[model samples]
Target: MAIFNTRDRTIECRIVYYGPGRGGKTTNLEYIHRAFRKQTIGEMVSINTTGDRTLFFDFLPMGLGKIRGCEVKVQLYTVPGQIRYGSTRKLVLKGVDGVVFVADSLEVRRKENMLSLKDLQQNLAEQNKNIFKIPLVYQYNKRDLAEEGVPIMPVEVMERDLNSKLKIPSLPASAVNGKGVGATLKECLKLTLHHLQEELKWAVQDGL
Candidate 1:
């Protein structure tokens, strides 16, 4: 659920980047912070936990215009993908409005990707949010590894393994190189804002 500030005329929402450990979630945030400097409102904060790091930053998207006369403020976050950080992952997802699952493209990580996704589904369910209904996007990261003679799954196979049932928007990306990063975030933002619009309408109608 997004926080609606009637007095400030602003609506703030959270979007989390989730996937297996070392799946390039942090890289995506770094690229966005570097490339979209004008839209970023604060320093990118990173919380280190043994083997993984959780990161977040606030972003004010431009050109999408206001929603119900309120400016949309987005808070982007990445959950630590290590399995030991289950509690932390759930905490990060507490009030998520959208999600970007950054699956690793390496063939060896196929199982890790599936497991992480299942963990996501369970975590969302715990919060009374359905994974299928939430605004979600799939990003198969590290496509560039293929060019380096590394074994990587084809996008079709990744979709079959991860998104065949959901059929949400999925993109092949090389986050470290900035490929598809902007597009992935853009698509997620579009879906999230659209979802929020309907929610806001209901709130108004219900006199909340």
Candidate 2:
């Protein structure tokens, strides 16, 4: 859900980057925090466990200027990707307005990718949000790892495994080097705002 602050004429929306452990969710947020300094309103807060994996979530609050009379603010978050952190992941997803699913391209993580996506759907269901209806995008990260002799799944195979049914927008990215990071965030933001616009129209129609 989006928080509309009437006093400030602003709407704050939550977008989460979700995926399997070590899939570059945190890297994406870190890159954004570094790359978009002017747009960022607050310092990014990241809590990492011993292995440097996100323990809770990485938060970056940013202002995206005004849209349709309301100042649009966005809170970007990355849920803890480790399987043992399932409860924390679910809690991070509460009131999420949009999501970017970061799928690891390593061949060894194929099953982990599928399982993480299923976990995402289950968590969203718990929050009463249909996974299909909500604004979602997929990021196939670590594509550059093939150069180092790392076995990686082909883009087509990843699509078949993760996006066969939903068929939403997907991007190939190496978040560590910042490739496709901005594009992924922009697409998610676009979809989220569009969804909110539709909801606003419906609310007005119902009131009328």
Candidate 3:
């Protein structure tokens, strides 16, 4: 849900980074926070728990400047990827406007990736939202691991598994090293803005 602050002429949109445990969802946000330091509204807030993984969520707010006279503010969040944090994940996605599914490219995480995607769909359903209709992007992260002698899933395989039905653009990324991270985020923002535009147009038509 995008919130429009009429008095301030600003629009605030929430985008969530979601995936299985240790799949680089938080890394993506960290990279953006560091890379776009000037646009960052505040320090990135993170809470780690078991095994030093995210316990709740990571938040980073950004200012994207004015769009058609309305200042665009984006609140980025990453859900705790651990399976035990299912309820926490659902809470983080409460008013999400877009999502970047950061699927780990490690061959061993294939099953976990699938399960996380299913969980996202189920949670969205519980909110009365259609997963198919939501603005979403896929990121095949941890590609750099392959060079370290780690078995990584091929981009083709990842796409086949995660994007076959969603048909959204999927980008290969190595979030830790900043490769493809910006592009993945850019695509997500583009799709989200387009969705918001259509929504605004519909509202105007309804008022007419």
Candidate 4:
């Protein structure tokens, strides 16, 4: 979950961008970093290795407005999407309050998306977070390639494949050109707000 420093009167939330390797996970965060540089509180940090790269960036999200008189700060992150980096994916998801699953559109990556989604579920389960219940968003990234007979799984196909049971917000996105990026974020922000309320309620009851 995002770190909200109530002692310091700051609300911080962690949102993880997750998908298979080369799914544009990094590209999505980079787009946000560039698009909101003025409002971003820090730089986008990428820890690159020969195997994979993990990236993170933060933004003072005014769009989420105020919750209990505290403004919301969003920390965007992406795990090393490579399959062999499974440990790293779970590590990065550690305290995630929200998630953006960036699925690749290429026809060849269909199984990869399915695998990544399952990986996400397993990783989150290790932390007691449930995809069926979390504040989640799905970005069918690389939508621009839809016409190329690429994986371009129809929205319904993805829904059936990934979101059949859980009805989180999903959008067609092109992270390279920034289409649907902000919209995807806004929807997640709303879900996050609702999630926080649920969390607060549980906290009131000592996590029930």
TM-score, candidate 1, is 0.89
Native-structure RMSD, model 4: 4.3
* lDDT against the true structure, each candidate: 0.85, 0.92, 0.90, 0.76
For 1-208, candidate 3 gives per-residue lDDT tens digits of: 8997777778889999999999998889999999999889999999998687999999999998876667888999999999989999999999898999999999999999999999999999998888898899999999999999999999999988888899998998999999999999889988887788777542222211
RMSD of 2: 3.1
Q: What TM-score fits each model?
A: 0.89, 0.94, 0.94, 0.85
Writing each residue's lDDT as its tens digit, candidate 1 over 61-126 gives 333335456667788888888888899889888999999999999999999999999999999999
Per-residue lDDT of candidate 4, residues 1-208 (tens digit): 6555666556677888888888888888778888876657777777766545543322223224454566667777788777877876777789888888988877678899999999999988889878888888999989888666554677788888888887777999999999988888878877876788666532222221
The runs of at least 3 residues in candidate 2 whose Cα sits more than 4 Å from the true structure, single-residue gaps closed, are: 201-208
| Highest-lDDT candidate | 2
Write candidate 2's Cα lDDT for 1-208 as tens digits. Answer: 8987777777889999999999999999999999999999999999999989899999999998766667889999999999999999998999999999999999999999999999999999999999999999999999999999989999999999999999999999999999999999999988888887776431222211
What's the C-alpha lDDT at position 15 in model 2? Answer: 99
lDDT-based ranking: 2, 3, 1, 4
